[model samples]
Target: MAAHMKEQTVKVKTRPDYSKQLITDIRWLLWAVTIGGLLLAAYCIHNGYVGSLPWLSAMVGLPWTAHGVVCSFYLNMAKSDHKEGGITFESAKANSFVADETNTEGPMG
Candidate 1:
């Protein structure tokens, strides 16, 4: 007679999603820099150090530029997630039935 052998499976752990936290941190940092830059610019203008106005403006604008870039990245991520069958806002809209000129009777029809 042959001996019976037992098999066992091991479980793996997955890392927690930190994207939301990271974005929140980035948002706070951007707000801080923008507000601080504005205050510094105002101080410089008050003391007649107008020569640094342009630089200050650029400093303040940096956060807005970074926000735009972050938005683009988020858009791309949403697109990729939709393609992967993830439930995103775009996917929900796509799956919903809406009566439009192109679809006279909607999805049911």
Candidate 2:
């Protein structure tokens, strides 16, 4: 009776998406930089390094922290709202890329 039954097989993709992995790694890097910068700033203040050179740590760390914050903001803004279905293209972006009559500057008048 078992011989009369047929067997079925399923195939799966062998290749992995490296781009997705790279994106995830980059996100982790942003978090690391933010935390590292804050720690470095704290260390500099605690050890009185600011007495000799006040702006060194701030110059180095603040930009990195700001960069991480910017990245996080964009990331959050980009997340799709599954519950709400999705965002409309017009509402998602404040400005449209489509050309309008106002932009008249050209290579030749």
Candidate 3:
């Protein structure tokens, strides 16, 4: 006779979702960099040093790049929200004024 062996199932714990927190942190860091870059750009422009063109361009570009990244993040969030059945302003408005089928009174009556 063969002995029967019992198998045990172990449940694995999942890590909490940190994607939103990570995105928020990244946005904050980018905004900080954008502010710092704009300030540096202003300083570079005011000083008008001959060889500072590269530095000025880099400083100016940094803020624009940061802005673009933040905007892209927002766009991605909106797209994901729409895909996930999240309600939007337009959807809310359309859903708000659903005609009541049971109503028999006319507007003139």
1 or 3: which has the higher lDDT?
A: 1
- Evaluated at residue 91, the lDDT of candidate 3 is 61
* Candidate 3 C-alpha lDDT tens digits along 29-76: 766776877787777767884554676557657766866786687677
- Each candidate structure's TM-score, on Cα atoms with residue i matched to residue i, is 0.56, 0.35, 0.37
Scored by TM-score, the top model is 1
lDDT by residue (62-102, candidate 1, tens digit) is 77798778868866775676664666545557867353333
| RMSD to true structure for each model, in Å | 13.7, 15.5, 16.5
Q: Of models 2 and 3, which has the larger lDDT?
A: 3
Summed over model 3, clashes come to 0
**Which of 1 and 3 is the better model by TM-score?**
1
Residue 42 in candidate 3, Cα distance off native in Å: 0.7
Task: Tell me the lDDT of model 1 at 43.
Answer: 86
Task: Give the lDDT ranking, best first.
Answer: 1, 3, 2
Question: What is candidate 2's local distance difference test score?
Answer: 0.54
Residue 68, model 3, lDDT: 73
- lDDT digits (tens) for residues 72-104 of candidate 2: 664565464212334534443434535434434
